[model samples]
Target: MLGQALLMALRALRLNLLRSLLTMLGIVIGVASVVTVLAIGSGAQSQVTRQIRAIGANVLMINPGAARQGGLRLKAGTRATLTEGDVDAILEQVPQVRAAAGSIAGSAQAVRENRNWNTTVNGTTTNHFVVRDWTLSSGRTFNATEEAMAGKVAVLGSVVARELFGTDDPVGAEIRVMNVPFEVVGVLSPKGPDQDDVAFVPLSTAKLRFLGSAGGTARDAVAYILAKAVSDEAMARAKASIEDLLRQRHRIQDDQEDDFKVQDPSAAAEAQRGATRTVAILLTSIAGVSLLVGGISIMNIMIVSVTERTREIGIRRALGARGRDIRLQFLCESLVLCLAGGLVGVVLGATISLTVARSAGWTTVIDPSAVAVAVGFSAITGLFFGLYPAHRAARLDPVEALKAE
Candidate 1:
């Protein structure tokens, strides 16, 4: 009996294939939109997490500033109270700290003969590399002797090397920074586009050559300090220990405000993740509205179908067919239509996602759960919308239906 009803439903839909395809358009669009947005959003979240982790886990940043009332944070280097000595103190006194480095940064024009490029110039010790988990791609970093003697040696990031030297080896090359000559000692491994436009020099060279006496006393001025904890579990303790040590060194009274900020990368990553999730939820909700519109379209079309097949329904009933059988047939037709739309939508959505990723250079992670949810929602929509039309067809009196034209 069920097989016969299903066959009838298929036959009725086949008679008007064009109309049926048009009716499924709304469902296809809704499902495709929802899946595509989710895929893109998930990919963005994952990319952010990877970038943050690339900065190294168990790492903390110490900036010279005070947190003001009303949750406002003063800009980095606002106080200029932290110095190289603070870095040494943190490494020595804080048991949780594994390593620390003092750093300062400024922008300068790099020139190698005719080829010139504007890039960031970073002044830092060897420990800065360790704190950042960065490795040299070629040659060696400056040794302690060069750092202490203030030798004019530099390391170039991938972008800087390509811009100034092209295919030529940058190692053993002399590049002028701010009109001051410095020999390139090494090239750093690429760290994406954002970090590749920078050049690293010994702390003493940067201080003596560029950014002289800008922030504070030359002997005591540094932009910030980067520190690595012994392990992930020690990060909190390291933060607390550094804070206490700085407070004591600065001689701040119990009530006086702290002139520094300690930042945890994990906390920053979590905040970004939370924001991504919120945006995903909002987009999904908007997409759901489209699905609701599709459901209404299905309801309207099913009603019209029942009306057009009134004579067929009456003939079936007159042949001793049960009302339940008529209702199930109509409901099955609606389900099949939605299911087909869902399958098509999945393919469309994946294709769009891949195209966007390739064209825009944005990451896209297609989630299996999202596909499952979309297909499941379509099935539910079919059942919910098909109910009233199926019941209406089942309730019609055979005598009355047979009398209609």
Candidate 2:
């Protein structure tokens, strides 16, 4: 009986195909808007989380002082004031610190025979790889003895390897730093372009041999300390301890803010996710306005539809059809219109998401849940907007409706 009613309603839609399509336009736009906005927002959130996870969980950074000073305001491009001693103090004094290493960076041109490539030269110790979860593909990292001796050896980042050696194995190859030869000990695994555009050497070797001094070039230390916490729960305590220690060590007054800045990865991830969520809500809310307009269009179309179908309603009622039955038939017609439009809109939204992801190079994660919501809302909009027109049709005087026709 329900199937027959549905088929009959579908036949009515086919009879006035253009009218049905025009009526469903609002639903189509409403559903598509909801889906595309949410998909893009969710994709941005996922991309941010993935990048943060790659950096590591429960991570924090203590960068050098703010670019300010008393009577001696430092301009941009000034050297960092952070030193190796500060990192050592954090390792020794901060209770929750599990591992820590200091680092320095400089830009230099690396040359191997006829090949020359511009690269960032990083100066750090062995534990840098361990803390960063880096793997060496060949040879070995410099031992404490080699570091103490300030040996002229280097590690090649993946891109540097490709640039200098092509397909050949670069381990044991000789690469020059500003024309001074240094033996390549190993190649770091591919860890993405940002981390793979550099060369690595012991801090002592880089400062003494390449950078022009034994007591660190320009009498400046370039140690960027990266530390891991003992556990996730201990990260907050670890960060607090490091901050307090640096403040006291720097002799920062209570009224004055600490010069050094420490960043926590887990905390930063949470904050970023929160901001993304807010943006999603704001975007959906604006899309909701489009949906509301769609609902109004549905109501307007249904009212016109009811008038056009009045003669049919009159004939059905004259043949012993109840007012409620007439109402159900009209309601079903509207439901079918919006429901079909919703399905089309879902496909449209998915296509839009996938196209944007491929062309714009954004990460698009389509939430299946969002499809359900959009479709369900479309159905509700159909019923809600169809109600008044259905009621007006049901209350029509059959004889009067027939006589007017």
Report the number of the highest-lDDT candidate.
Answer: 1
Candidate 1 lDDT over residue span 41-121, tens digit each: 999898888877667768899998753446776565566788888988998999999889888898899999999999999
In model 1, what is the error at residue 177, expressed in angstroms? 1.6
189 Cα displacement, candidate 1 (Å): 2.1
State the TM-score for model 2: 0.83
Models 1 onward score TM values of 0.83, 0.83
- lDDT of model number 2: 0.80
